[model samples]
Target: MTGAVVAGAVVGGTAVLGGCAASPTAPPSATARADVTRVTVRLDDADALDDVVAATWALGVEALREGEDDDGTVVSPSSLLTALAMLGEGAGDGHAPFDAALGAVGDERTDAVNALLAALARYEGDPALVAADKLPVVPMLHTAQQIVVDDDATPQRAFLDRLAAGYGAGVVVDDLATRSDALDEFARTHTGGLVPTSPITPDPNLVAVLQDAVVLAAAWKTPFDVALSGDQPFTVVGERVLVPTMEGEFDTAAVSADGWQAVRLPYRDDLVADLYLPPEGSAAADDPSAAEPTTLAGLSTALDDAAADRVLVRLPTIDLESTTDLMTLLAGLGIVGADLTGVVEGSAVQAVQQAVLQVDEEGTRAAAVTSVGVTESLRMPPPNQVVLDRPFLMVVRDTTTGWPVFLAEVLDPRAG
Candidate 1:
């Protein structure tokens, strides 16, 4: 299913409860910076970070499936394989250890997803025999590591060298003095392009005590065009302002209530990038009079029978750039058990684990970009359209495992 369609459905239902506005584009304020920094530092603890990431991914998948009839059943086996491949690629030589750690997490996630899929199949009125057929499920995980050193003979270097030997790989060293004439470039390139290396240190004494993990990044096959997209009038707080619109055809599911609507948008390539848009007067702020809180359950009900078939979908071409620091994001998901503190599993002891992930626009400008440009021109022809001029929730999911990859709020089109 297309992201726009899926997101349209989620948004249509949520619209009944409240409305959303785009987030403004500005540098992080003092408090925001502190919050981000704290989250980043806390995520450096490996064990805690892993648990948090897992929990967050699970929640995202479950939330996306809550209103769908699929019952959480895994759909495409190839999709699952692709996700596993990405995990493996990220792990590099650490695939074995990473797999071992993932195995330790058990099959609870797999079982849960399959059970949901089975329920969904039944709901679709499939035969009992068909529903009982065993579905193939394969889950994979991996880890990748990079070590920084000032000299090959140092204790820190020796520890990393030993670790690399175990993984059957050799370490590569670079000179920082001539590189950009600064320590920043050297650290950025050598440490997997992650900034603020303050969170990671090469302590010889702690080498054996540390745990390493992998990170994955993915996007949709079809991208939004920026050139064709133009500023259009959008309503916010009873006032109208021009917002950029990238129109395109997308597979979507939507619902409507009294005077509100919700929509779901799914990307073509990755399960992540699911968006939910709500209608006017349905904002879910602290007070109902302030805004309405849209629930997954409400969306499912609204998409019933006739309502599902009647939703008019003329989706705007939207260009969005989203970056997520996996570690910090997981911490925000309420997985306190895996924070900097250790987690106790029965009699087993597990310390916090470290995994870093960062995504940037990286040369994707608004104009002259082929992918975004094509999608933008799609709206010129006459067709039924739905303007997304309000706030919405965007979710990234793994189709194979039905796991949520990430979630963010598109508060402002300009900022996105």
Candidate 2:
């Protein structure tokens, strides 16, 4: 389903929440600097940060779970987090809802993001894109942020400064009124063409638009043998169906508690998929989001309480795609007061996003592109196997820093 956009053109406004009142003009492209400064961190405070990140990710998974359909879910927690962090910067440091959504207590909201983003950006590697003729390829995680404003409007200088400094959002002054194609081109090129057309379109009352793009492609440490993969029974709730399963004996970490079995499946260098499988026949919870905190914490707690064991695991191969309206979803999560029209003569405001993910014997390729329109308005808004033969919760996380980048509740890999 699509998000809600401001129908009529946004006319006059000079509110801090909206764009500036300057005439339209395009600015220089915002390029990322090679050197990024790291925040001073301590080991004692690490657990708190992890808890906040876990809770924040749980909200993102909840938003997806509450979506229209039950098709196997796929989303980037990091993507949503980066987008929200940008918005939080737009609202300044004291915005309660924005800060709360990001799991920050006070002025630390943006800092939390800085720490996480820098953390992810620091431990970089090539993507595991197996070359047809060459050996393999490891690509860096591509993450970019930009504020595309109509040539007629201008963004708050302070907001832009914080956004650029804290969130790394570059300012892109564009003539969206006459050439919306340029906006589309930005989305396409930045996301490595994962998103062919920009989700943003032309709108007269358009002002400034916020954006974030993220892409991750990785290979598995021990590639699953295609010969070992074959048709296996997969249960969609109580109903069973046949699907391709990646079978192998992997030496990995596992956690078992409260009758739920959680296993980590390692991907090539630094990523892993944490699978939470309940004891056989245990009914799946209605609200999977409700379980994220406990489950995610359990995964971390398991790291200390449980030991790594060489477990025989069989996981299903999955390819899933989804489009979610984050504006509405974030609103539902209690982040109030999003003023996309602080200063501009134009229409309504909205946020729209498209994403795709595929997993098999190789590794994984996932891309997400989100567009914030200049015109009016806002609209709104995974897996496992033990034998993973049954429906289970899955988290696509970065092993280096233990960040749950993507989360899914997979019932039928065949559904979507």
Error of 1 at 85 (Å): 21
- Tell me the number of clashing residue pairs for each predicted model: 74, 45
Q: What lDDT tens digits, residue by residue, belong to model 2 across residues 220-261?
A: 667777888888898775677898888876666776777777
Candidate topping TM-score: 2
TM-score of 1: 0.38
Candidate 1 Cα errors over 4 Å, as ranges: 1-227, 235-238, 255-272, 285-385
Tens-digit lDDT track of model 1 for 251-343:
455655554445544333323333445655565311111222234324433432222132233233334422111222222332212211111
- How well does model 1 score by local distance difference test? 0.27
